[model samples]
Target: MEEVDVVIVGAGIVGLSVAEKLSHSFDNILLVEKEDSFGRHISSRNSEVIHSGIYYPKNTLKAKLCVKGNELLYNFLEKNNLPYKKCGKLIIAIQKNELPILDELYQNGISNGVKNLEIISSKKAKEIEPLFKSCGALFVPSTGIMDTHKVMKKLEFLSEQNGVLISYNTEISAIQKQDDEYILSFKSDDFQVKTKILINCAGLWSDKISEMVGINSEKNDYKLLFCKGEYYKTTKYKDIKHLVYPVPDPKGIFLGIHTRINLNGELSFGPNAYYVDKIDYQMDDSYHQEFYESVKNFLEIDFDDISQDDCGIRAKLQKEGEKFRDFVISNEKNKGFPNFINLIGIESPGLTCCLSIAEYVEKIIE
Candidate 1:
């Protein structure tokens, strides 16, 4: 068995971020990925939005990390010459009744220390976005979009440059915790490694990974719920300047089907939330009308202009009707699994929180 000081599973944004930061200090770092390349799952899919730390409960990991990560990510992007847009965002309220929710979101953002969040009147919103029709809007100046692929590639490059050994097409089928190290067995390849630290950054299979090491995720209230969100690309809007979002679902289920502008000046709407049994990228056309209605509620878009784009699954901890759930980043020493770090239910703001999350994990290991 090859022995290492640290083993990081999964090559998603968060995992890559962790490896890149830790590689600066730690030697013999091994990053293992199941896919042939990095970021095949959640990292590659979705809006690639740099969330502005809004909507999450105050003092939660999601809130703190996202707000902090927003700053760190922008700095990292600039330093590395990675492409991104500080294109801003607007959470709009269409009906008069929804204005309260808009206020609540602004307040929540303020409580979470999000800067430059404002409640703009209809005329002010129109001045910013003429096509946007709303009673009121929460203008979030910090929200932006970046090329996730570019970000991941840069992170991978930096990590590799620092002597981080990345093993692709290798999946950890099982894991066992010895006295002070973890023994990881590969699925197809007959190989195992003993590492002093095991960081479970596995995006979708995090709960399963926890269970493999005798950690009952459910008992610890870190159970995984696979919620799939589908997006639809728009043909009508191309040069839209900012991300246009509807008021969040009243049930507090999701951020609602909103308009996301990519870094390449492309527009897509969606990520309407629903549960899925298995991981599949196949887009269902049945929800196109639903997408149309949702977009029409906030933006002036015809149904025919939108087409089925793609989908991404979120590793959620909260089930349907559950108002809120925070990201679970824990060093399981108290659970008898010292040096084993588990990150669970890292969904929406996860991409935004990648760098800050890495710093959080670094402090834990220290």
Candidate 2:
């Protein structure tokens, strides 16, 4: 069996960020991923939105880390010459009834310490985005978009250059805590490893990993609910300069389907949410009319203007109809697993919070 100082499971953006940050301090660090390449799942499939810490509750991990990560991400991107746009975002109210929700979000942003957030009138909203239809809008100036693939790749490179061994096409089938070290069973070559520290950064399968290590996922309330979102694109609505959003779900669930401009400067909309039972990436076009109906509340679009583009699944901790849940990150020593760290429910704002999440995890180990 191979021995290492630390072993991090999953090589998504969060895992890569953790590896990059920890490699400088620890030797013999190893990162393993089941996929043949990095960011093949949630990390790459997201809206790639650099969240502004607006929607999350104040002082929560999502809010604090997102705000801190926003600054860190910008600095990291600038230092590495990564491509990103500080394009700003709008959470709009299409009717008078929705104005209160916009104001509430503005207040939430303020409480969360999000800077430069303003509640703009429909006139000012039109002045900023002439095509958008809104009664009022919350302007988040710090919101932005970035090339997620580029960020993941750069983190991979930096970690490797710093002597962190990253193995692709590798999977940890099982793990056992043996006294002070964790013995990991892998898929290939009777491959096994013993690590003094085990960090579970597996995004979607994080709960299963926790189960393998003797933590009852259901009992611990660490179960992951798969909430899938679908997107659509349109060439007719060209030149969308910034993100445009509808008022969030009344239950504080999800931000409704909205418009997003990719890194290539193309206009697209979607990410209507629904719970799924399995992990499937098939794009369902059945909601074509529904998408049109929902999006027309905030933007002008013809029925024939859009087509199904892509979809992504979020490993949410909050079940349908449940209120917001914070990210689950902690050392499991009290749970009978010392030096074992688990990060569960790392969904949206995770990308924006990657570096800060890594820092938080590092502190846990220290």
Model 1 per-residue lDDT tens digits across residues 277-355: 9888887698999998888877788889899998899999988888898888999999998889999998989999999
Stretches of candidate 1 exceeding 4 Å from the true structure: none
Candidate 2 lDDT: 0.91
TM-scores for every candidate against the unseen true structure: 0.98, 0.98
What lDDT does the true structure give each of the candidates? Answer: 0.91, 0.91
* Residue-level error in angstroms, candidate 1, position 333: 0.7
lDDT of 2 by residue, 1-366 (tens): 899999999999999999999998998999999999999999988799999998888889999999999999999999999999999998888899989988888899899888999998999999999998888889999999999999999999999999999999999999988997899998775878999899999999999999999999889999999989898999986767789998877765578888878888888786888888999999867999988999887777888999989898998999878889999999999998987999999998899999999999999983
Please list the residue runs of candidate 2 whose C-alpha ends up more than 4 Å from where it truly belongs after superposition.
none
What's the CA error at residue 127 for candidate 1, in Å?
1.2
